[model samples]
Target: MKATIERATLLKSLSHVQSVVERRNTIPILSNVLIEASADGAIKLMATDLDLQIVESISAQVEQAGATTISAHTLFDIARKLPEGSQVLLHAAEGKMLIQAGRARFNLSTLPRDDFPVIAEGDLPTSFELPAETLKQIIDKTRFAISTEETRYYLNGIYFHVSDEGQPVLKAAATDGHRLARVTVPRPDGADGMPGIIIPRKCIGELRKLLDEVEGSVAVSLSASKIRFGLGSAILTSKLIDGTFPDYSRVIPTGNDKLLKIDPRSFEEGVDRVATIATEKTRAVKMALDRDKITLSVTSPENGTAAEEVSGAFQGEGFEIGFNARYLLDILGQIDSDLVELHLADAAAPTLIRENDRSPALYVLMPMRV
Candidate 1:
């Protein structure tokens, strides 16, 4: 393949596809990206790591219609280091791929284009278009709660499904047994019959990069076993996790009657200060609530103890609970409002947290025996 592509344009396209290529590979071809130059003055770059694949198309001046495979990271690095506005020429001679930009030239080993594996397209039964900003909100709010433990593989991905509310709404949820996060947004058209799918953690991370600073709508296609997201000139296709996610609806507490309203910043600061004396293993902070005062304390046999008091509006009975300080801070960081509400049942039962009275996002944190 022989083509001339601008340095900036080539770097942007390479940045999108090269991330899918694994650094270490058992199959040599899997470490390479397939580059195809067509007669229509366009170039296509494709990369994959078995379960996930990315294909991007960029305009270039084509001298010959051909295809070749070259190391994805190596090519991306060379393009990034080239002088700005410089034109990069890529050509195939004998069995090596030649890259030339101004005075810099390099020959890279090439793999046969036929050896590149392509993810087979499946019959997607449901399709929808979602605004990129709304999609980003769903991922950002719930991704932090996704489990990293490999043993419970079912909880390692975000659960995407339609809610059972009176009106249809799209919901994204994630939990790691210690904490759960749920966010709901208005459902898009053609998403009524979409089946629930667990999107793998790695796929979610890569998908976030594509949604950054993007506007307009993203085309999404879903099936029972696979899903695809179309982002402008780039496309991402990933295999769905084969495990069933737990019924998260049952985990959210419904009847927590004790209410505490406080400034989120104040509560967060108090927790952070008192948590300093917590043991490294537990990192547990205790909360004691009275009529209009809340005391955050941490006690460790070897590390001593710390206590900080903050003012809040409380109703019902006084109560105390213990929780992981880091988990509390994570949930608090996601809240966008000045005041946050905490609904408590007891010291042992799970506590519900919300940014405000009518916010669509909810967080449930399990209590620890301090």
Candidate 2:
């Protein structure tokens, strides 16, 4: 296979696929990208790590129609370091792939294209399309709460399902026992009968990259075991996690009657300032909500204590709760409104947080002992 592609175009395509290739692999071919050149003036690049696969196509001047596999990272690095606007030529011959750009040249080892594993495109029973911005919003709001612990594998991905409401709505949720984030958006057409699927954490990261700065619509396809996303010129396919997510609805607090309204930015800043004296082990911050003010304080036997008062409106009885400072900050960062509403029942009960904008997104936090 031989083709000539612009440096910028080649780098963009390689950047998208190379990230799917793991740095260490038991199979040599899995470490390389499959490059297929066709006489139709386009080249396809594919990379996979068994669990996730990315395929991208770029326009190129094809001199011959054939296919081969070359080290994905190596080729990406070579293309990235080449002079901007330079034309890159790739030629496969005699068990080696030749790469040339301007005065630079390098020979890379090649694996037979037949050895690369290709994920079969089975019949997808469910398919739909949604605006790219909508998908990005759902992912951004919930991904941070996904569990990194491998033991409870079910919590390692976002749980996606349609709500049981009479009106069609799509919901995405993630939880790690400490905090939970859930977001709901109007369901797109053709997505009514889609089953719940757990999209793995790594897959979400890669999919976000593809949707970054992308407008227009993204096509989604789902099966019982796998999920696929179609971006403009690229495609991502991932295997779904085979576990049941816990009943997240039971954990969300419904009886929290105390309502406290405060400026999110000021509250976040107050927590940050008081948390400076918090112990590194727990990073715990105590919040005391009174009639018209909320006090954020942190006390450590060895580091002393710090406190800051922020003005707020509170109803019902005043209460105090302890929470992880980092976790609280994370939840506050996702709020897009100037005012944040915290619904609380007591010191030990889970607190519900929502922005004033009423975007159908809510966060639940389990209190920590200070």
Candidate 2 residue 138 C-alpha distance from true site, Å: 0.3
Highest TM-score, which number? 2
On the 0 to 100 scale, the lDDT of residue 85 in model 2 is 96
Report every candidate's CA lDDT.
Answer: 0.92, 0.92
Q: CA shift at 162, candidate 1, in angstroms?
A: 1.1
Supply candidate 1's per-residue lDDT for 66.
95
Q: Residue by residue across 191-250, what tens digits does model 2's lDDT show? A: 888889899999999999899947899999998789999999999999999999999999
Q: How high is each candidate's TM-score?
A: 0.97, 0.98
Q: Cα RMSD for candidate 1?
A: 1.3
RMSD of 2: 1.1
